[model samples]
Target: MTAKLEKTLGAVSLWGIAVGLVISGEYFGWSYGWGISGTLGFLVTTIIVAAMYTCFIFSFTELTTAIPHAGGPFAYSRRAFGEKGGLIAGLATLIEFVFAPPAIAMAIGAYLNVQYPDLDPKIAAVGAYIVFMTLNILGVKLAAMFELCVTILAVIELLVFMGVVAPGFAISNFVANGWAGSNEFSFGTLSAIFAAIPFAIWFFLAIEGAAMAAEEAKDPQRTIPKAYIAGILTLVVLALGVMIFAGGAGDWSKLSGINDPLPQAMKMVVGHNSNWLHMLVWIGLFGLIASFHGIILGYSRQFFALSRAGYLPKSLSTLSRFKTPHRAILAGGVIGIIAIFSDGVVNLQGMSLTAAMITIAVFGAIVMYIMSMLSLFKLRRSEPNLNRTYRAPFYPIVPGIALVLAVLCLIAMVWFNQVITLIFLAMMFVGYVYFSMTKHQRENAEEDLMLVGDNH
Candidate 1:
């Protein structure tokens, strides 16, 4: 039977996908994790990280506009590097997404527990996970619609919190008492920033969602670049607002002890009324669910792409009636179920932080992105005749600056969180072995099946 064509998504829908980045647990975790360093420090650090995020998005947007395929980083790496390169990119993405859902689910559980002190956190997490997984299996069109709605609500919630909280400005919490429970700056503050980098990135990583859906994007070359710019700009605006709101609400020094720093800022303006906190919690819950939905959808496409390229089970590459990669969606659900147990590894905050570290370990994605950006220069030299639509402004200089910033972020994440960094590396090594063994076995099986068919 002929395969059904996949539906194309518009630029506005893609922007919704981009905005989903802000509601993630990583964003909250970063604000909380670094809130210890005072508001000014958080602002300074976020600017550096945001700059890196912007460059990464631009480089990725250039590639997506150039190759507009379903594979996201998998397609880019495959084209630029080859099968092995593609496999690594695909594997790193799997690791990243595998850890993401549970982190979000667990965060929901944590917040819910605070609201309903009697509720079991584990139960809350499991229920949210099941709900999110169901939403994903239903397919992308539905998921995008959900994303569009949640993105709007979440953005409005962010702005409301900022506006409400901004008026309660106390210059006290803005000072430097150190967010950490330490005495001096020494290597500790630097170490905390390193630890913070991975989770900090979680808020910014899915700007490539539009790219992953490139094959299903109407006029992808035009739509994808537009989505990238819009998405990144949206993130920058919200992120900057978050920093400003957090800074203005109270003294930066006192922010160190607050775990849910955003909500804490919200409370300063709205007061400690249970009704107000409940409303904010519900909004936060929406943010968590929306983030999980986007992560699963984006990563499943990467899984489908890898399988099509022979790096994963061919079943995962199979499409359903809706042209969705149903098998990959199922595989991701199973992996996510197991990853949910990582919540058992620690409380909500620890799992979220660990997931973030695993995410940045995709130095491979950054590496591939840098190569793709450099390839822009090479392609200009080699394939000047290739059709050009939207070129990254400033050409070599923009990409060059982006490459340097990405390198710095990677180094910083690695230096501070060497343990989690090693965990991420270990996971990648396991993926390499699995890829090698599976590829060899599949090739041998195919040969045997062909021989038997011929003999018959």
Candidate 2:
């Protein structure tokens, strides 16, 4: 028998969970942008991406509140464009959640390698997935509370990282070849900025993950918007703070391509293998773990939602004794573990496994953003009588900004990582074909299961 989920999460917990979902972005992912465009150039990318997220979160909140479901964008697009549309959206989300964790896991491995060179990074990464997935399977509230606590620790470490690096900061260092050694206003510099979009968007990539928890929140209509807004604001502050301070403290280019940027920044300030740097190497992983765990929660919910709604196997939707989506969590974890070990085989064109995966994940996120915004515009005109607890501020304008920027980013990814973009499209095509053939039978089964009302 499947257990029912409890609605025990409150506003504060919701905010924490939301922040936890993407806090690691501040820690490591954004540094890759500096590799492409240097400090000033990446800053341009960050500002534009920040603007995109601001519009996206506001518009996303309205749709999430009006129809609070664990499916997140999948649920919204499903309502607006029917089952096939929903399947596409759901697959995109699955890509976002599933692919993201492997990147985080790879980052985790790189961090551990920095601290204890003897530890095989891949083994440690697989261990992390094993430990965290077990915690996720045990219970949702426990997992959420754990996420909140680790997120707080991560936030504190980021502040401490800033303090340690601040005294050494120099404006000249930040601007040194700031456009990645390109001539001023040249096509090379412009091209670098466009290529930096994925890394910039990584700064707040999964802030939308919070909305996926709506089904388990207390009074989601009120709690969902509050969490989304507060969460985005918090991330913007952290992203800029860390980026500017770290960029100013060092050459910026040296740490640009690494998975563990903060520790490298500390090394520049304090000296080689400084105790302070070594300490951060261990503690900084809390930041990665926060996102690692939180994203697991997100992907599990997405898997459960699709399964329960006839988009995937009905068996995957069944809750455990603790009322958590255990099977969903397990399934995603297994795929992630495979991705980590098989990283050697998953390369696209000339991109490294980590870069290819990150770009592919961004591809999924951008698609969902574009579709979700379209769904918001469609529903507003077609479903005038629908109850909406919160309206997106700025109406079509907010979603319009997000949609345009997302499309631009998509264009950027195609130009920069064409092979991975093509690979992502192939994945979508395969998934759509499978979903279309099985959906009707699955839908009827799902409706019947809903009537069963399983508990304990």
Candidate 3:
């Protein structure tokens, strides 16, 4: 018998997965924006990116409700534009989901290193991959419940961080050198803001990943909209709150270009040995883990969906006795582990591995966003009679905004990170080649499977 995914998730679990998938952005990786754009410039970049995500999610939710497929964007794009579009969307999403974890894993290692100075961050990162991948292979219910627990704790920890640092938030400090090259708005400051798009995008990069769980979500039409709307609102408040407070805490420059910015910001306020600093360092790990674990779920689902559809190796679609996509989870984990270990070997214009990975992931995310918005438009025209439980409020205006911003972000990312952009394109080229080679075989396999189903 062919294995099917169990439908056990509800609105609440979906919400947790949504928030957890992107919460690590609240912890680290975003500070790299401060390195290039300074406080004020990056803030501008963040606001623009945040608006894009808000619009994107609100519109993207409509497609998720209408289709409710595990392939998410791949499914939507394939329906709208055919097999080639499916390949593009699937590859972009795989890149985004697969590459994001290594960056988060590195941050997890960095957070642990604060408490255990003797530990090697790389070893810790690899260990995280092992533990989380195992949890994912166990079952969706177990994995999502764990995600909920950590996401709630992670949200609380960020609130506590803001409160602890509230007293030390001086406006003058935050605004000092806020612009990249000057104290006021200029061509240089504008350039810096554009360059900061990827880091700003980091804040809500994977919120739409919730859609990947639609196949397992109960009453997906009703639940997904609730989860996505709530998730986006929750993240916006947290992202703005955390960034403003962190920047105002002290010399924001000190927090830039590192994986553990929150703890360092807290340490500046409460001293290195303060109990609060230690608390933030330890509990802060939950934030990283939330994203790390949740994204493993997201990527594995994408892998399983693609393989089941014959785009990838059929073995990847196999389910364990526990009913989880075991091979898919491990496959993504192996790719992430390779990325984690390649920290120093893959240099991109003197950028840190974390930053380079973030840029590459953001590139994939932008491409996917553009494709998704286009799919939404195409489907609306092609299937106007389709059942859409919850329609996007503003129609073309809403998704139009998302599409335009995504295009702009992609342009900015490519301009600022040429080497990384080339690598991302190269990866996509390789994936397309593989798809072309296997296309005929996949079609024949589908025909044989259908014939067997008819006989049965």
| Candidate that scores best on lDDT | 3
TM-score of the candidate numbered 1?
0.86
- Taken over the whole model, the C-alpha lDDT of each candidate is 0.64, 0.85, 0.91
Q: Estimate each model's TM-score.
A: 0.86, 0.95, 0.97
Better of 2 and 3 by lDDT: 3
Cα deviation of 53, candidate 3, in Å: 0.3
Ranking by TM-score: 3, 2, 1
- Top candidate on TM-score is 3
Q: Looking at model 3, report the run of 10 residues with the lowest lDDT sum.
A: 447-456
RMSD of each: 5.5, 3.2, 2.8
Against the correct fold, how does model 3 do in TM-score? 0.97
Q: lDDT score, residue 282, model 1?
A: 78
**Arrange candidates by lDDT, highest first: which order?**
3, 2, 1
Query: How well does candidate 1 score on lDDT at residue 97?
Result: 61
Model 1 clashing residue pairs (backbone): 36-179, 172-251, 173-251, 173-252, 173-253, 174-251, 174-252
Clashes of 3: 0
